[model samples]
Target: MQGVEFAKDLIQKEIRGLELLFQSLDEDEKFNEALQVMSNVKGKVIVTAVGKSGHVGKKIAASLASTGTPSFFIHSTEGVHGDLGMVEQEDVVIMISNSGETLEVLNLLPTLKKIGVTTISITRDKESTLAQASDIALSYTYEEEADHLNLAPTTSSTICLVIGDALACALSNKKDFTKEDFHLYHPGGSLGRNLST
Candidate 1:
């Protein structure tokens, strides 16, 4: 299965990139600050993305919310319509874009900037427009599995999802978020059944 092999190699490359990123953050101060910000959050973690990234953003928002970080997903394309009202100055925005140049997301960058919302961008390109706009840029770039034929998103999306998981767990640990806290937010699925009394 050549396709399977390709997938495995892609996964390995992504894992390597993530390993490097985690190793580079050996000093806990930056991470600690992010955690503290999450713990003291007065509003929700608003996750935004376009296309495939939007799918990942929705899942990430759920993960963070269940882990005790209040979060919600917003479609970037809809931001200008009426969804923009959902964002508050007190909230932190997590923007997801594989190329970091997503048109829908870029279109709303000016508005977000004007409104004074703190943003964190997750992208494969560290120097992308979205990354530059963000207060904190989290890189998910994979140098090895470079699929320039639009297939790069498969690996890149997984990388972004994993990074989101890492952020959620790290913040949960910092806030001492417990299983009970997770259960409170996710009380309808199979996970809720397992966590229920």
Candidate 2:
């Protein structure tokens, strides 16, 4: 029962954070700016991150790609080696860092700036280095993580994922993405099977 109680408490905390995020989304002008940039992107959306955020970024990239946004995820470590070449001047890059100071992701900024691609960032603080350096910053406020220790990335990462989802959905709708378009990119899944008919 203690473990179950812990789970419930954690879940509730995260839910509360999400509710706050949803409310703030209506007031965040940067989100709208980010959406406009994404909608106008002529090249692919490149997502980069490190640690746990990197995992969430990969899911975000996949979601964007399948929903009519051309996108791909490149690990920050791999990006510096040669993968950064995949990014082009027309691309829009989205970087995620909880503290907005992750060196690996920050290091990519100089080259990205030189490439002259638009950059957006997801972080907890609008003033964070990652946010300040970005063309637009989509940020959130959370009291703490949803764990007993309040150190894990549960809440913050959830917000990042939600932000990514909001962007993907809004952009898809703005662009008038159709069921046929979704089916075109996702042809092997149960979703695709259903859309086929």
Candidate 3:
């Protein structure tokens, strides 16, 4: 296949996968509960994940932090080492894992609970250990990836990113976050200039 056709196919496949994700969100009520939990967080939203999910988690944390919610990404492996101290009792943890069984993520759960921190999970498997252990779980199930093997995490990661955005937006709306508030956090980029004007 030509490069253009390949790109088009990938985009189309991702669109379909996102459509499925939207449908899943519509059917699940846990998303709203998760948002409510996050909206009430008295401290930062601690985002954690492993591998590709970790990269997505970082973006999610940045999105949340910029959009009126205080948040930061803590690599699961790093958390176990010493970064876990950054998490406080008032914070809410959002752990991301497509399978919901990432060892690093799961390992931090008990410690979080012991510290009196609330945990939220974004995962494809509601029954997975991470989901079951979380105070709230936002399901982000996807049918398949755009790649032929369906193992590159294209679709799943996209859905995860969207879910993170959804949560950030919801929290921002709840807080009545205005463009002025956004500008305070982002005062150097084009976005800052746009919001300032």
Candidate 4:
């Protein structure tokens, strides 16, 4: 029963954190700017991050790619190892970092700029180095973690995932993406079967 109670408490905390995220996004104009930048991207959307943020980045990239936007995820550490060639001048890079101070992510910024790539950052800290360097920064802030120790990344990572979905959905709507278009990319599942008919 104690474990069940703990689980319930964590769920409640995460819900409250999500509410805060929505409120903050409503007040931040950068959210719209970030969407605009993504919508207008002439080349692919390159997403990069390290650690757990990298996991979230991969999902974000996939969401964007399946929803009419061409996107791919690159590990920040790998970017320094010649994978940076995957990035092009016209591309827009979406870098994710909770602290906004990930060394590998920061290290790639100069080269991204040198190649004229626009950067959009998703981070909790508006004043973080990642946010400061970004052409557009989508800030998501929360007061507490769902985890009891507050050491885990439960809340912040959820915020990142939700924001990434918002970006993908917003871009899809802006581009008038339809079920038919989605089917073209996702043609191997129940969703594809539904879209076909």
TM-score for each prediction? 0.85, 0.97, 0.96, 0.96
Candidate numbers sorted by TM-score from highest down? 2, 4, 3, 1
Best model number under lDDT? 2
The whole-model lDDT of each prediction reads: 0.80, 0.93, 0.90, 0.91
- Writing each residue's lDDT as its tens digit, candidate 1 over 1-197 gives 36878677666766776776667567435445555666677888999998889999999998898888889999998997889989888888888998888989888788788778778887878789988888877765465543535465666777778878988998888888888888878788888999996
Runs with alpha carbons beyond 4 Å of true place in candidate 4 = none
Candidate 2 regions exceeding 4 Å error are: none
Candidate 2: give its CA RMSD in angstroms.
1.0
Output the lDDT of residue 81, model 3. 96
Per model, state how many residue pairs clash: 0, 0, 0, 0
Q: What lDDT does candidate 1 reach at residue 46?
A: 91
Which stretches in model 3 have alpha-carbon errors above 4 Å?
Answer: none
lDDT per residue for candidate 3 within 1-197, as digits (tens), equals: 66999889888888987898888877889988888888888888999999999999999999999999989999999999999999999999999999998999999987898999989899999999988998888876666788877889898898899999888998899999998898999998788888878
RMSD of each: 2.6, 1.0, 1.1, 1.1
lDDT of 2 by residue, 21-51 (tens): 9999889899999999999988899999999
Least well predicted 10-residue stretch by lDDT in candidate 4:
22-31
Write model 4 residue lDDT over 1-197, tens digit each, in one string: 36999999988888888999888876889888888888888999999999989999999999999999999999999999999999999899999999999999999998998999999998889899999999988887788888988978898889899999999999999999998899999998898888888
